[model samples]
Target: MVAPRKYPLELRERAVRMYRTSDPRPQIKRLAVDLGVHPEALRGWIRQAEADRGERDDRLATAEKEELAQLRREVKELRRANEILRTASAFFAGQLDPTRPR
Candidate 1:
C-alpha cells in the first residue's frame, strides 16, 4: 500500500503552477522554503510535471508510472498463481502414482 502524501494535491499543483508561470524561474530550494515543503519533493514534482507535459524524458509521466505499477502487480499475482498450480499438479501426480504403496 502506498503511504499518504505529506503535502496535499492542491498545494502541489499550486506550487507547480507558481513555478511554471513565474517570469523568472525560482530556485527549487527557495521555493520549497517559501512553501514549507522539502526541496527534493518540489524538485520531483517539477520533474514529474515536466514529464507529463512532454518537456522532459528522464522520468515517466504519472499515467505511465501508474500503468507500470499495475503491470508489476499483475505479474506478481500471475507468478504466485502459477506457483500454486505447479504445486497442485505435483501433489496430484504424486497421489496418482501406482509404483508406490497406497
Candidate 2:
C-alpha cells in the first residue's frame, strides 16, 4: 500500500505554483520557511516540476520514474521465479538419478 503523503497535495500544488508564478524565482530555503516545509522537500518539488515540464534533462519525469520502478519490480519478480525453477529442476534431477537410493 502507498504511504500517506507528509504534505497535502493542495499545499504542494500551491507552493509549486507560488514558486513558478513569481516574477523573479524565489530562494528555495526562504520559500520553504514561508511555507513551513523542509527546504530539501521544496527543492525536490521544484526539480520534479521542472522535469515534468521538460525544462530539466538531468532528472526523470514522474511518469518515467513510475515506469522505471514498475520495470524494476518486474525484473525482481522474474529473478525470483527463475531461482525457484532452478531449484525445482535440481531437485527433480536428483530424484531421477538411477543409483542414488533404492
Candidate 3:
C-alpha cells in the first residue's frame, strides 16, 4: 500500500510552479528550506513537472510509472496463484491414481 504523503498535493504543485516561474531558478536546497521540504524531494517534483510538460524525457512520466507498478503487482499475484494451482493439480492427480494404495 502507498503511504500518505507528508506534503499535500497543493503544496507540491505550488512549489514546482514557483520554481518554474522564478526569474532565476533558485538552488534546490535553498528553495527546499524555504518550503520546509527535503531538497531531494523538491528536485524530484521539479523533474516530474518537467516530464509532464514534455520538457524532459530522462524518466518515465508519472502516469506511466504508476501503471507499471500496478502491472508488476498484478504479474506477481498471477505467478503466485499459478504456483498454488500447479501444486494442487499434482496432489489431486496423485490421489486419483489407482496404482497407489489409498
- Model 3 residue runs over 4 Å out of place are 100-102
lDDT against true structure, model 1: 0.94
Runs in model 2 lying further than 4 Å from the true structure: 1-3, 99-102
lDDT tens digits by residue: candidate 2, 1-102:
899999998888899999999979899899999999999999899899999999999999999999999999999999999999999998898889977774
Q: Which candidate is the best by TM-score?
A: 1
Residues 1-102 of candidate 3 have per-residue lDDT tens digits of: 689998999999999999989989889899999999999999999999999888898988888889999999999999999999999998998889979765
* Candidate 1 residue lDDT tens string, 12-101: 999999999987999989999999999999998999999999999889999999999999999999999999999999888889997866
RMSD of 2: 2.1
Residue 73, model 1, lDDT: 95
Clashes of each: 0, 0, 0
Q: Could you give the candidate ranking by TM-score, starting with the highest?
A: 1, 2, 3
Candidate 3, residue 98: lDDT: 71
What overall lDDT goes with each candidate model? 0.94, 0.94, 0.93
What does the lDDT read for residue 71 in candidate 3?
100
